[model samples]
Target: MSVQTWTWILVGITFALYFGIAIWARAGSTKEFYVAGGGVSPLANGMATAADWMSAASFISMAGIISFAGYDGSVYLMGWTGGYVLLALLLAPYLRKFGKFTVPDFIGDRYYSNGARTVAVICALIVSFTYVAGQMRGVGIVFSQFLQVEIIWGVVIGMCIVLVFAFLGGMKGITYTQVAQYCVLIFAFMVPAFFISFQMTGDIIPQIGMGGTLEDGTYLLDKLDALHTQLGFKEYTTGSKSTWDVFAITLALMVGTAGLPHVIVRFFTVPKVKDARKSAGYALFLIAILYTTAPAISVFSRTNLIETVSETKYSEIPEWFKNWENTGLIAWTDKNGDGKIQYIAGSAIDGKKPVYTEARGSYGERLIANASAAKNELYVDRDIMVLANPEIAGLPNWVIALVAAGGLAAALSTAAGLLLVISTSISHDLIKKQIRPDISDKSELMWARGSIFVAILIAGYFGINPPGFVAATVALAFGLAAASFFPAIILGIFDKRMNKEGAISGMVVGILLMLFYMMKYKLDMFGGGTQDDWWFGTSPEGFGTVAMIVNVVISLVVSRLTSEPPVEVQEIVENIRIPSGAGEASAH
Candidate 1:
């Protein structure tokens, strides 16, 4: 069967299964909508959390980013996975013990201030919306390639499917559906990885295969390093980012991961505090399976890409090349009219204009080249590497189709989770808690569903008419979370004297600082600056670390100046720290 046929079949089946789960697990009450009725098992919650955490960035983009960034990409692996440890040890169980349906609920009640809750809700909306834009884009990308539909239509379709599950089933439906999504996505990701590993190194394990000796009896890393040098790129095993930047970026991502409201809200769904702890561990384990394999896949794909495309004649390039090129993800210009493609590091060549000048097929069967003169004549979108891997390696069409489904699963699962957080914060925190405390449960549920519908539409709009700001919004989202929520939540739990004044002030300052820095550098706002202008050589991505530190310090200083929290609030903190009687504590 054609790839499209297989893609439609696999994607259709997964969609049907998700819709069925939604129907079977439709939410009945506000509790079900918000926290799955607090009956989720640890293991199921863990898998669902894994699915929720791994977005399009993980599924479609991480390996590709690693493939190009090489060792610098380790920050992503370490930062993301390390945050789970923080979540498990520092926040998850305590928050679960607090027994709230959402993160804002805890923040509001802990501070005994509706203002704090409103701030938390705003942060949640910002982070969730920024993150969901990327997921929607991932959906559009996959649909554009696999289903041969326009990207806008693909996003619309994705928004509709998500609305069906998220609007109807709420957290209960999302949880069970995520369990299935985890299975499908993991299988789809690992199958091609295993096949490619064996094909490259005669080993079934991608981790070992990356380090193992190849058929030529040379170590894979050694060969990759040599190829990298030959092409004028950095060695695959080494990185070019400064040590401080790496450390800061890693720290920011770690704290940001723990701070993200969507991931934190997952802990609230479990039945017990112990389940939340166990679920965090399970989530880490499941996430590690993919995280550990990504670097290996990165090495394999980079090596495969170089070997397959380097010095190949443009006309004779692989069928996959042409296919992706038509999607505008892969492009080549025949510099020097050589009719041969050059795949080398961009830095290796200077002052050589590409021979293909026209926007149309002036390049003769290829789109106009957007890539400047480089060692290579081709520009391959980093996002397409993983999706194109199977075809590049001549894998079966079904495996390719499976990848499409997996990409959607990852994107949609995370999107659903973020959208839920957005909806819940508005409906439960802003409306029910602050605006209309007397609202009925049915009315709250209705508002939640309505919010989901509106959020999806807004997210879809961003996906279709994505602003320039949306490009780096994912990292910025992490930065915002790190600067705002991580400090507030951690201090709230660990410090009894931290009052609402301190928490709210810190979050506002932290998020604003991070946002200002990101806007200045990323969007060239505030009179336009370059990396050279960054404070202490910290790029926008790493500036969150500085902002987080400032948040902590400011929070501590402000809290010392302000009156201590009420006696009830202090007791609330002490009670959450203890595991004994946790079930009873949550019963309140």
Candidate 2:
């Protein structure tokens, strides 16, 4: 069968599987809706957490970022994965021990203030909505690309499917559905990778293939390094960024990962504190499988793409090239109006000087004008590398179809997780906690569904009208999460003396500073120019690291100057830390 037809079949089967599981596991009570009745096994919870954590960014964007980012992209791999270590060791188990259904529940009760809970709720809504927008768009993009539907129609169809499962079963439905998504998505990701690895280097494992020798007996990294040098680019492995910038970006990602409301809320489904710890450990293992493999995929795909396109004449470029080119994902302009395409360094532009100079060429000497000098420039969107991997490597059509379904699964599972957090914050945190403590469970559930319905429309709008590239949007979202919520959650967990004053102050400072910095560079808030740059030359993607440090410093300073929490609050912190007194387990 053709790739498009096979994609529909694979996607159909996957959706049927998800819907069946969701209906079979429909939620009955508020506990089921919020925490899956606290009976999830460590392994199941780990799988669900993996699905929750791996959003559109991980599935569709990260490899693309790495493909172009070279050494600088290591920050994302290190930052995102490293954050889980902090989550497992410092936060997840304790939060689970606190035995709350949602993040706001812990904040409100521990701080003994509804205002603190409200702040947490607002922060959660902002982060989750920002995140969901990208996931929905990812789903639409994959559908439109592989299944040949219009983007808006694809998005609408995706939203209806998600609503069916997310609203019907809530956390109870999302859990099992996410588990299935984890299976489909992971399998889809690895299969083409395996084929590509073997095709390139005779290596079955992509992680090894990244550093392995190619069929020509040359090192893979060496070839990439050589290609980059020829292209007026830096070395593939070592970053050009300052140590402080790297450190800050990595730290921000770690803190942001630990603080993510959707991820943290997954732990609430585990039966006990110890189970949460075990689940986190397992979740890391699952996530590591993909994270470690992603760089390999990036390297292999980039190498393959350059070699393939470099050999093709402009007139003879394949149908796939024309298809993606129409999307503006791949564009070529012949500066000299020559019919033949030029793939060369220092000659892509008509009058601009080469990006590299011989004096400081650490990536090695350039091979200027290696191809024809029509000075044709090729602009390939980073998002295409991963999605087109199977076609690039000449893998089977089924594999491509499977990847399309997998991409949708990854995006949908994450969207569901984010929407759940958004809805819960509005219904449970805002309405139940503050507006009407005596509201019926039915009313709260009704509000939760209503909030999600509204959130879907708003998030869908952003998805259709995305502000920037997928990875950049996601990075900014992470930056926001790092700034607003990471410090509060960490202080609440680790420090007995951290008061509501400290938490509130830290969140405000962190989020506002991050927003200001991002807007300055991204939206030209302070006038667009080289002069309106970051304080230490950090890119907006890496600015979260700075914001996180600021948050930690401010939180510590404010807490030290203020009085400690009351005896009750101190005991609450201690209780969260311990493994005992985790209440009765609910039915699985």
Candidate 3:
């Protein structure tokens, strides 16, 4: 069957399964809507958590980033992996024991201030929206390529689909849907890796196949390194980022992962503190399956990409290349009028992306609207590597279609989780806890569903116009979370003296500083400086670590100068730290 036919078949079947789960597990009350009734089995919650943790960023963009950035891209892998560990070990058990429906709920009760809760709600909204934009963008990328639709329309379609399950079942529906999604996405990701691995090096395991020699008896990494040298790029295995920058980026990603609200809320679904710990353990092993395989896929795809297209004539390029070019993610210009692609170092066009002309080039290729003078004649978006890998490897049509389904599963699962956070923050944190403490369960549930609908609309717009690459956008969201929430949560739990004043002040300052730096560097808002203007040589992605430190310092100083937290709040903190059981987790 054709790839498109198979894509429809697989996507239809998987989406049907998701919709079925949503129907079977629809929430009947606010409790079910918020934390799956806080009674989910540890294993099921773990699978759901694993699915929620691995978003489109992990499934689609992480390997793509690693493939292009080479050794420098290890920051994403290291930072995210370490960040998950940080969340699981350092935060999950305590928060679960605290028995809050959401992170902001925990903050409100722990800090003994509705104002503090409001600030945390704002932070969660910002981070969740920013993160969901990337997932929406990933959905658009998959649909635009395989479903043969414009990116904007793809995002719209995705928004409708997410709204169905989210509005119907809320957290209950999302959790079980994610469990099924985990199965689909993991299968989708691993199958392609196995196929390409065996095809390339006669090894079934991509991890081993990456290190295995080619049919010509050449080491794969060695050949890729030689390709780098030939193309005037740095060695594939060598680091390009400065030492401090690498550290900064890695640390930022780690803390950012820990601070992410959607991931944090996963622990609350389990029945007990011990169950939360067990859930974390199960999630770690489940998550490791893909995390370990990503780099191998990166190596295989990068090597395949170069060998297939480098110096190849535009007219003779394969169907996959043209299909992608039509989507405007890949572009080739006859810079030297040689009618062949020159994939090499440096930007290929005026900026990073190519502007399109309404006309085709001499070789029937898309014409660049603002072509650059650089010698490099190819422009390939890093986000496309994973999606295009199977096609690039000439794999079977069913495998190619499965990847599309898997990419959607990864994207939609996380998107549902994020939208739920946004919904719960408004409905539970903002409305029920603050404005209308006496509101009925039915009204709150209505408010939650209404909020999800609005959130999906906003997320769809951002998907149509994302700030940067999918992974890059997600990293900025992490920075926002780290700068805002990580300090408050850590200090509130570990420091008996962390009053509301300190927590609120630290959160306000940290997030604003992060926004300023991100806009100045990433969005080019504040004078739009270059890499040379980075504070202490840290990139925007790594600036979160700096902002987090500043938050910590400010939090400590403010807390020491201010009056201590109320005796009751301190008692609440001490109670959360007690690992005995859920006996006193209900203390206020």
Candidate 4:
């Protein structure tokens, strides 16, 4: 069967299964819509949490970034994975004991002010929107290649699919669906790694194969380093980023992971604090399977890409190149009229991405309007590396099709989780909790469903016009989370005197600082400046660490100067940490 045929078959089956789960597990009340009725077992919650946490950033773009950025990209791996551990051990169980349905709920009730809840809601929307944009873009990228559609239409399609599940079953539907998604995405991610590993190094374990040698006894990493030097790029194993920037990015990702509202919300689904800890453990174990495999896949892809396409004739380029080229994710220009692709380190185009012209060159390669004056002549979107890896290696069509399914599963699962957070923030925190406290569960559920519809449309638009690639965009979302939420939640739980004034002031300042920095560097807004002008040598991606520190400092200073939290509020904080009388057998 053709790859497209297999893709249709596999995607069709997965979609059907998702739809079936959504119907069977549809939420009947606001509780189920928000946290799966608080009845989920540890194993199921762990699977769902892993699926929720591992968005398109993990499945599609993380390896792609590592493949291109080489050692510098390890920050993402360390930051995100470490951030999960921080959340699991440092925050998850405590937040679960706090027994809030959403981050805004915790912030509102803990701060003893509706104002604090409002600020948290805004932060949640910002972080979740930014994160969902990446998932949407990932969805668009996968569909554009395998289903052969434009990115915009692919995004629209993804929005529709997510709407069906989110609207019908809310968190209950999303949870069960995510468990299935975890299974599909993991299987899909591993199959190609196994195939490429055995084919390249006579080893089936990608982790082992990455270190193993080729037929000529050349160590794989050594060969890649040699290839990179041959083409004037940094050696694959050498670090180019400064130590501070690396540390900054890692810290931002770690705390940002801890601060993320959607992931925090996952612990609320379990029945007890113990169950939350257990689920976090299970999720870490499941997530490790992919996290460890990614670096190996990165090595395999970087080596395969350099060997397969470097200086190759355009007319004779592999089928995968043309297939992705047709989607505009892969483009090559005949610079110097050589009719061969120059896949080197420098910028291939004047801009970050290719601006393709309707016309084709003499060699039939796509013509880009903004081709750089430099000798480089190829542009490959980093998000496509994982999806293209299977095709690049000429894996079986079934394996390739399965990857397409996995990519969508990874993307859609996270998208649903983010959308749910957005919906809950608006419907529960803003509308029901603040404006209409008297509203019944039925009306709140309606509003929640309504919000998802609007959120999906907006999310699709951002996906169609993302600020950056999948993983980069997600990193910024982490920065937002770190900047705004981490301080408030930590101080709220650990410090009894932390007041609403301090928490609100800190969130506003941190998020605004992050937005200003991101816009100035990433979008050239706020009087845009060059990379050299970054504050304290931090990249926009890593600036979250600075923002987070500022947030914490400001929060502490303001709290000391302001009136202390109410007696009841202080007691709530003290009780969550008591550890005993946690009602281990009772559901929230």
The candidate maximizing TM-score is 4
lDDT tens digits, residue span 481-516, model 2: 998888788788888988888888888788888888
Model 3 scores a C-alpha lDDT of 0.91
lDDT of each: 0.85, 0.80, 0.91, 0.93
Which candidate should be chosen as best, given lDDT against the real structure?
Answer: 4
Write the residue-wise lDDT of candidate 1 on 410-524 in tens digits. Answer: 9889989899999999999999999999999999998999999999999998776542322244666788899999998998898999999999999999989988988788767
lDDT of 1 at 160: 88
RMSD of 4: 1.0
Q: Is candidate 1 or candidate 4 better by lDDT?
A: 4
TM-score for each predicted model, relative to the true structure: 0.95, 0.91, 0.98, 0.99
**What residue pairs clash in candidate 4, if any at all?**
none
Tell me the deviation in Å of residue 234 in model 2: 2.4
Off by over 4 Å in 1: 347-364, 369-375, 464-473
Task: State model 1's lDDT.
Answer: 0.85
Question: Which stretches of candidate 2 lie above 4 Å from their native place?
Answer: 149-153, 343-376, 529-532, 580-588
Off by over 4 Å in 4: none
Clashing pairs in 1: 342-376
